[model samples]
Target chain A: MTTKRSITVTVNGQQHQTEVEPRMLLVHYLREVLDLTGTHIGCNTSQCGACVVMLNGEAIKSCTVLAVQADGGEVLTIEGLAPEGGLHPIQEGFWEKHGLQCGFCTPGMIMASYQLLKNNPHPTETEIRRGLEGNICRCTGYQNIVKAVQDASERMSTSAETPVPAGD
Target chain B: MSVPAAFDYHPATSVDEAIALLQQYGDEAKLLAGGHSLIPAMKLRLSQPEHLIDIGKISSLSYIREEQDHIVIGGLTTYVQIEQSDLLRKHFPLLPEATSMVGDQQVRNRGTIGGSIAHSDPAADLPGVVLALKAEIVVQGPQGKRTIPADDFFVDTFTTALAPDEILIEFRLPKATGSTGSAYDKLANKASHYAIAGCAAVITRGQDGSCSAASIAITGATVRTIRARAVENALVGKQLSETVIAEAVSHATDGEDMIVDIHGSEEYRRKMAAVVARRAIMRALERI
Candidate 1:
């Protein structure tokens, strides 16, 4: 018999309670079960970071994490980074700087950059490159992604700390 | 998409609870911490366990603290915690250095030191660093708790000295003091992020600037992480110069089982093993 586990995950400010199979990956749970398709799965083997998400305020490869493992945890996916009315600075930076081409790796890249900028605030070019090592992009060659992160860092540093809006 | 086979899951809240679970399930159960390594293996069908004891939520086992004679790192402490630890960075900097090369930011956030060492992957970074540091691991079984030195902890690839019912609880690393220097250098396989060849060196110099104690451990070139005793023997009581370090590191591939895969041939890996060992030792000398 297949064992099922119950999990309460807060995705993008909304709380979700679901019963998932013990073998289910978190990325599959978000996409197949929860219909949060924004988080892509590039490599199931965990080499690519397309399944990156913020688990309890830290960036982790969702594909590598089992759904049951994330039970009772706060998860902030790519969908939850921005407020209801607007896009987050990272999204704005990607748009303004043309951070991605094809956009498949964009979500993971942005999510990883989100963690990097949050921790380092003003990361150097090398640090930004190092920060996104897990993520792979076949398009844009990552020059624009670096620019987008730098842009977001500049905007975020000059503005208030709460880049993600609350109460909506 | 890859998915693991169905298995009973138990979230263990404490060390005793986890140990009891392990004892109950015995060989059928596997402890899941971080899941960065085990889950991937399960997905590939490389490993199958009827039961999985999730120790990731065991908050008591995730820590890094300074003790009187050594540093105590909890079994579940993630790589990110180690990378950002001031105590580790100030003292045993090789840990952070090697951990930085493990995977990426996200992997580090979830991959625990205990999980890495316990998994004992031939190319894993932590084992090499632990072997270099002469660390000891604390294990708890149905009988009681026992300490195993790093040298004896890793038995073979994908295997450890841990019994089926034993749970690794903590890593005790000797505190680095005085003129101590350590470094880790690796040539990462660009695709898999596993090391093609990696070496870690720890050296403590005497008052007269001579090598008082030295340790060298290398990974990826063999089926298991190995201490390059030949290299250590050459470095002790000698002045660490470029020429001396070069001669000492050349013996890194001596008396070892080398791994041959699509990544590199036996001959190539053997040569690169020495190269990385040289680079690691030189870097350690610079820090000293």
Candidate 2:
């Protein structure tokens, strides 16, 4: 018999202290435990980026991370990107630029782009393509996705007074 | 959803504590560093140890500092950290260059230097880089701490010299002296981004414009990472030109078992290894 470990993870801005199975993955903990299903699990083999999330301010695939491994760590999922109702700038870009055809890869794509634009405010088209190389959108050939990121970069870079970082 | 088999998770905060846990669990325990490589295997039910001593939070075991004549890097330093480090860029330029090409952005954020090297994955890039730089691996067990040369550390694919009770602590890389240059080249498999053929070269030039010292190591193409001593011997004391480097790197797969996987064939990889080795050597030469 295996014992359950108690872990506390700060997701978005809310604190959730829960008991989980030792083998439970972070994505499972989010979806099944905390009910944050924004982070998807496409391949489960770590090849696809559908499970990407911001763990301690760095992007990592949630399926590859154990719930116990993320003990005391801060996680920012797609659910936490904006307040309850409205969309974040990157999400707005996707909606405005038609970045998604089926929207399966949007959450992971947005979370990844959130980090990329945070790190490099003004990313070139090549940089955007490189930044999103891990994500796969089977519906769109990614021409519009690149435009969506470019659209977000301009929106975030221009709108801020005194240059407040987009994702901070 | 694939899940790991039920196992006890022991989070150790110190090296001594982790070593004690290892002694307690014996062969049933496996140290979980970044959990990138091990987790996937566990999910596939390939590596189901009875216990996992979590050592990722051993805060002291993650750093990159210089002590005397050597550059000391702790085992848990992430590839992204190594890629952005100014100290490594100033002292060891090849580390940053090699790290930037390791994996995609998310993979690099979690995979650790010590974890990748200890796993000894044939497709992993850092193994060949460490072997090329001739770094020393530091390991600690219940008995005491010991250092092993990079040449001897990686015994075979998915294997290392570390016993079940010993944990990799850090790597001690000798600071390159004089005008030294190093590079890594590979033909990456598209989906996994792993090398079908990878070569890493470190060369130091003498004041006479000849090769003073050379260390070349290969991965992905072979069953294990092996030192290309014949290629190294051919370059020393010779003025390295395109023709000489081409001739020297021709012995890249002289005596080795080439890996044949779905990603590539033995014949294809053997041919790619030579071309990749020449490119790596030529790039190193250009940097000098």
- A1-168, model 1: which lDDT tens digit per residue? 867888898777778899888988999999999999999999888878898989888888999999888887788888888866778889989999999899999999989998998789999999999999999998746999999999999888787755663212
Q: Which segments of model 1 are wrong by more than 4 Å?
A: A160-162, A165-168
lDDT for each residue of candidate 2 in B33-119, tens digit (9 for 90 to 100): 988899999999999988999999998999999989899999999999999999988877778877888768998899999999999
Residue A149 displacement in candidate 1 (angstroms): 1.1
Q: What is the per-residue lDDT of model 2 for residues A44-122, given as tens digits with 9 covering 90 to 100? A: 9777788999998889999999999989988999988877787778888999999998888889999899889989989
User: Where does candidate 2 clash, by residue pair?
Assistant: none
- CA-lDDT, candidates in order: 0.89, 0.89
lDDT of 1 by residue, B1-288 (tens): 688888999999987899899888888899999998999999998888989999999888898999899999999999989998999998898999998899988989999999999999999898999999999999998899999999998888888999888888899999877798999999889977899999999999999999999999999988899999999999999988889988988889897888899999988998899999999988888898
On a 0 to 1 DockQ scale, where is model 1? 0.87
Candidate 1 CAPRI assessment class:
high
C-alpha TM-scores of all predictions: 0.97, 0.97
lDDT at B194, model 2: 85
